[model samples]
Target: MTDQPTTASPAATSPAATPSPLAQLPGAVGAPTAEHYGDPVAEQRALAAGRALVDLSDRGVVTLTGPDRLRLLDSLTSQSLAGLAPGSSAETLLLDPNGRIEHAMHVVDDGETAWLIVEGAAAPAVAAWFDRMRFMMQVEVVDASAEWAVIGAMAPADAEPSIPAAAPNGHALVWRDPWAAVQSGGWQYAAEAAHPAADYPAVELIVERAFLAELAGLARAGGVRLAGSLAAQALRVAAWRPRFAAEVDEKSIPHETDWLRSAVHLAKGCYRGQETVAKVHNLGRPPRRLVMLHLDGSDAQLPPAGATVHAADADRAEVGRITSVARHHELGPIALAIVKRSLDVTVPLVVPVDGVDIAAAQEVIVPPEAGQSAAVPRIPRLGAKSR
Candidate 1:
């Protein structure tokens, strides 16, 4: 671990001045913005073309080492890390005894040591959890969160000068997350200031804040538009990705969150919450199921988060509630809903937003039965007058 000055530099000066295209973006939210990228589509396209680099430095990085590194992590996390080879990456969930996810992380193993990358907001608590559980394990955990800069780049099958080679000192290639081929390495800013690059490329993308805004303007000129937080939330939900707090609530079991395939190790011997996970899998049924909602009726208004969903045909009972909503230009309005699995799919579910009916249909993506009885519930329209 290297200790250096903690101050961040100002945004880049110009695109021509940097060696990496990724250096042009803002590392922190609400940083001085000379140019704003207006649309999500264009930003995604930029990523796909390797023309854009998203700043992920806000995320946290933690290192765990010592003889008991793998064993300690295996016991604490839901994933099986018994045989994780060096340079391998895996997604894992830190779950409470009851099975609710406390943290979802992407772990990179370097054979003898491991680095756990988690959402920025979850770093402190997760680090504390590790400390609390380190009763007698021969492990050392360090909060490397501030010492590293994380960057993400998505490129077409064939693109550019290729991802730079990993640095020799304290770098590891992590393949756990599905999005990109990620490498974590180190970068030295000055003789006295060195930090982990997490395998970010050596090419610098120097650009003034204004030029970034110009790039975003160019994207909008090309017909790409910005997506609000609602839109981003909806897209994530549609992709069946679980958010930390919303989907993985306090009472959630790992299976209920459908992370077993990605976050859990089915054959691993045991861990803190292993007993509960086994019992639930063997005897209990999942309480609530995650579903994608397709709203009908007037397209002018969309359902808001936390809107109650009630079955219109059956005893008018509450069946579910909207967790996220987004209005896509192409898809109209869509939402991610959490509902009781026992509710009839054929019955129409109404999302009332301020007494106005927002038509909704339940589309079960991760079915309660885990894909056995897949159904796409249709959204029903409100009455003619309501329309």
Candidate 2:
């Protein structure tokens, strides 16, 4: 999710300081890693099958050290992190006062430090926010993107031998994807009997920046297969995994993207934007909802992100915009969009890409009735029979 293209690396790190070895590999296209090494479809298949590693050096790393690291995060984020055990991985959100998402982080504690993996463009801001919040607290925030790099794989960290795990303080640094299961104290908006996320078991490994050359050598020597950010993004979109770089905007709330399944603790203590979160879940619905679009693959035109989505019926009014789009290896042309909550699920959608209208079929992700989880009792009528 943090692998988007960028002109400049994170502020704490200088891209000119040391060029990435993976970026120098043949067919590498993007600034940090190869977007796709010639064939994206094959890379997607290999990555999904746990036979390939995704280059994610563009991701940003931040560390919180000192005795109050966990407590500081627990007080500011949506997840209950005070009791997070060393080596445990979790996801959390930093919301604005009105519950709009500002930051989403994948966190892992290694006893001595709590490492946060976040969107590259937002890394310096995240670190600065943490620093601003620490008033006399025994905590130190550092942007570690310059010293560390991230690698993604579909297998667990321990199961992948080619990519060595970093154990700076006896605990290995790995942030396992927790989207497969609804986390404790979290709620789900999608009512599917079988979720696609169940099949997505992915992990992001943190390693020393110096090891990038070795990994590149391993890739070149045929010791390990390499995938690209494009493949990784396609898999994430297929899994319906909400990412900050793709799904979040200034007005986005957790409920709109179904992010509560993994990043939010519904019963956690008060933090910034807690009131809006509780009110939305207990008494109201989000203003918008997420949906997956099966684009008309016959046209061979894949709509890019931010493409305007319109209703295919008469008048063809705009309803939403595409947040993320990809050509899934198995699902053909697909996209994730945020539309008005009241849009008819049965209504067909059309995305205008380069003057032609590309037909799209809607599959609901966050249903229209995506909130009001409170257990309020119904009021009985005066003439109702008593059981």
Candidate 3:
């Protein structure tokens, strides 16, 4: 393990940066923490085999307490949290009035507190927003990022029932992922019978701050394997998991990422972006859609994040940009991109990197016909006659 060199990435050292517990680990480097501790592919394989654990401690955790906590959150986000039973987990999205995703959180209530797990990059901003929205609500929002460390569970073998797949154990509050299928009140825009996300089994364990070191030591001592961010991210991208930090931009909407499959409750009373969500799903189409790019493996070079994507044809115009890219142990190099909805699905795509074009084959993650299931009622005027 290498010693952590300097402070952090340029982004974290900025004004509102909130550091994480994992930043001090050996070989740890980066803004909030290290990208990996040497071998990313091995780490990824370990995670997939359920023989390891990854430090998602870089993510932020916000705890909401108070009598009106559930009610307040239900009125603010895309999920129905008011009726959520203690020990249950659910995901929700915070969007601008224009339906652009601003924050996403994996929520779990421990009877006394509602733990909101948000991406590290968006934590401080989201925590601040929660403070501003506390007009008259009885909810108390606290940025507990420094108080808790997240332990990720993925690829737990099917034989091990005690691998902690969502069930809370002792002091750990495990938030089970609902991305496997449509929740009770949620909707799946993608019509694929076998959703790629269904194969993704991931969970997060929230532990007390003081235990971070002991956990790291345990991983290093081979008590358990230590996987890196790449392993977790590779599986997430392969599953077509729509992450806010990557897939979302200023114009991003829930429909674009098929996030309604788990994050948004269509029948929920109301939320900030409900209007736009309703309008688009019922009457219009989202400007962009998500896709999985299985990149060409012949070339050793891989496209970096934010790389511009163009259709393979000579006259094809710029369609979208790569949001997240990873080299999967099995898939080689892969990426997740949000492209213009009108881009032909059959046409091959290419990503430009260092003046070179990498061939890409698109696997439709979010289909163009997403949200057609809304089925808006057509009401005729009072003067109209029956056909």
> How many pairs in model 3 have backbone atoms within 3 A of each other, for residues 3 or more apart or on separate chains, i.e. clashes?
1
Which is superior by lDDT, 1 or 3?
Answer: 3
Tens-digit lDDT string for candidate 3 (58-111): 777888888788887898899989988877789999877777787889998877
> What is the model-wide C-alpha lDDT for candidate 3?
0.78
**Model 2 per-residue lDDT at 158:** 45
TM-score of each: 0.67, 0.93, 0.88
Could you tell me which 10 consecutive residues in candidate 3 have the lowest summed lDDT?
1-10
Query: Model 2, range 1-387, lDDT digits (tens) per residue?
Result: 231212234443453234478878887777656788889999999999899998887788989999999889999889989999999999999988888898899999999999999877677778878887877889999988888888998974346535767999999898898898899988899999799998888899999988988999988898888888889988988888989988998899999989999999999898888999999999899999999999999988899999999999899999999999999999999999999999999999999988999999999999998898888899999999989
Candidate 1, lDDT over the whole model: 0.54
List all candidate RMSDs to the true structure.
14.1, 4.2, 6.1
Q: Which one is best on lDDT?
A: 2
In lDDT terms, how accurate is model 2?
0.87
Q: Model 1: how far is 252 from its true place, Å?
A: 1.5
Give per-residue CA lDDT, model 1, range 1-387, as digits (tens): 211112222224312122222233332223222122456555534443446545444455667878788888887777777667776667777766666666777777766667777665566556666766777998888766554434444323233322332322344443334322211211111111121112122121112223334444544454333222333343355445555646655566665545564576655777667767666555555677767777884757877677889887657788888877765445557777778867765677888787787778876644554322224464676653434
Among these predictions, the greatest TM-score belongs to 2
